[model samples]
Target: MTKIVLYARVSTADQTIEHQEAQARSAGFMIDEVVADKGESGLTTRLSERPEGRRLFDMLRDSDVLVVRWVDRLGRNYADVCDTIREFMRRGVIVRTVINNMTFDGATKDPMQQAVRDALIAFMAATAQAQAEATKEAQKAGIDHAKAAEDGRYLGRKPSFTTEQFQRVHDMLSQGAGVSMIAKSTSLSRQTIYRIKDNPTESAAALASWGL
Candidate 1:
């Protein structure tokens, strides 16, 4: 029997191991086990460097399937992500992702097939790293914006949602909830949800500025 293990790396307060598992389940993956590393930044830490991530290295066996929310959960950058996935494929472990239902396997002996697979892996890995970099930049910008706003001057109109709503939106967003789902669940407008999703820090800062 091929055992399936779900691995999650939770770096933010909004993200949780339960949410990760739920996302995988929703994607039709019957996870047999879950291994998670909390407070681990995928931007800075390699998979083997994480405690539970290292456990996965020793625990996964040939023919076993390893699942993740995305390839980004596997490493810190493009090279690291590529190397980690390749290493797993080399071990005969099938690596799969929930987001795009991506699969990487080393069982193929065909040269053309291998080339296509390798190219796809490279593209995905590069995309993951690019996303991480963009997120990091956004966080930095948010921090700077917050610091600038600390001078006691009101910035703009208060946010439409309360602090609780903001937190809920963030939680749902982290769980891979779509904007429409969140809008329906929270009763917030799609525009408001889009604003929050695009500038989470600014949204939170707006709430704080208004004492909401």
Candidate 2:
């Protein structure tokens, strides 16, 4: 029987594999196995370079389903993501995303359908690369700002939640959990939760600024 596999990449210390699994389950994916790589930056590292990621290429068989949170989870590089997805499709593995429920299948014989799928693959891969670049730039700016504020003139307010709490909030939000529920579960105020939800990169920057 064909199996369903979920691949998760946790690049930060506070991130957890369980959170990704939960998100997949909440998205109604009946996952048969999960492969995860901790501290692997999708922007800098190719999927084939990751230990578990390499296992995915080796283990997945034709007709199997491979799921990810987003196309970005495959790789943050445009060419890399495109190549990886195309390779999988060529092998008859159906690639799906939990976030948008997007699917890329190679089984279609219709020329029009093929054109549409290929176009979407290109667009999503390019968008993923662009977003990754933007995030990295944002992080660099945040770090520079934090360093420049060493004089104590503009240290900014200390973050209210710890790194773990921040990660929990992020994970819950991605799972489409209620803000109030997440706030209560994380023991964080609604305002703080909202702030985190509104701009998670800034929230992360705040934590990094404070060396949290």
Candidate 3:
């Protein structure tokens, strides 16, 4: 049987291991192996620079299967992701994703179908990359507007908890507090904690995540 390796990533350190694990599990794969690189984005680094990508380069054997949450996880950018997939397919490694169950294998001998698939993969990867970039730009615009509205005296919305209380919550999370403990201490629901873990860029990224 071919080995199946799963890779998950988040671009911010604010995310916790539990958050990503739950996503992968919900995607319906009993992860054989999970490799994650926190606080890094696939768009900013070469494939070889990523821990999971590097491991994939070395560990993949002919006919082995590789999986990720999405196509964006496979590349430095849209083009890079597509090139990597093609190379993996050429190496006889079958690539799959848990989200869409998309697969690429070297078994396709038809050139036309291969060309179409390549085009589609590139388009989809590029779209995802574009969406991420656009999101960043939008967040920048929002922050700028918010700052303007405050006439340089901008303060963030009054969070439910005081800054001191928030600091304690952050500290407790850092100190390995369980969700239940955090809930009891901060009085924030488990769901809020999970949301914080996924969209941890509270300074800017959280603004977009919260529809602000």
- How well is each residue in 133-168 modelled by candidate 1, as lDDT tens digits? 655655556556667787887668967986546655
Poorest stretch of ten by lDDT in candidate 2: 167-176
lDDT of 3 by residue, 7-49 (tens): 7776654445455567567777676777777767777886778
Local distance difference test, candidate 1: 0.81
Q: What's the lDDT for residue 138 in model 3?
A: 45
Q: Name the TM-score of candidate 2.
A: 0.80
**The 10-residue segment with the lowest total lDDT in model 3:** 159-168
- Candidate lDDT scores, in order, read 0.81, 0.83, 0.65
All-Cα superposition RMSD per candidate: 4.3, 4.0, 9.5
Deviating ranges (above 4 Å) for candidate 2 = 160-205
Best by TM-score: 2
Model 3 has an lDDT value of: 0.65
lDDT of 2: 0.83
| Backbone clash count, each prediction separately | 0, 0, 0
Better of 2 and 3 by TM-score: 2
What shift in Å separates residue 112 of candidate 2 from its native position after superposition? 1.7
Top model by lDDT, which number?
A: 2
Write the residue-wise lDDT of candidate 2 on 160-194 in tens digits. 99877875565456546798888877899999999
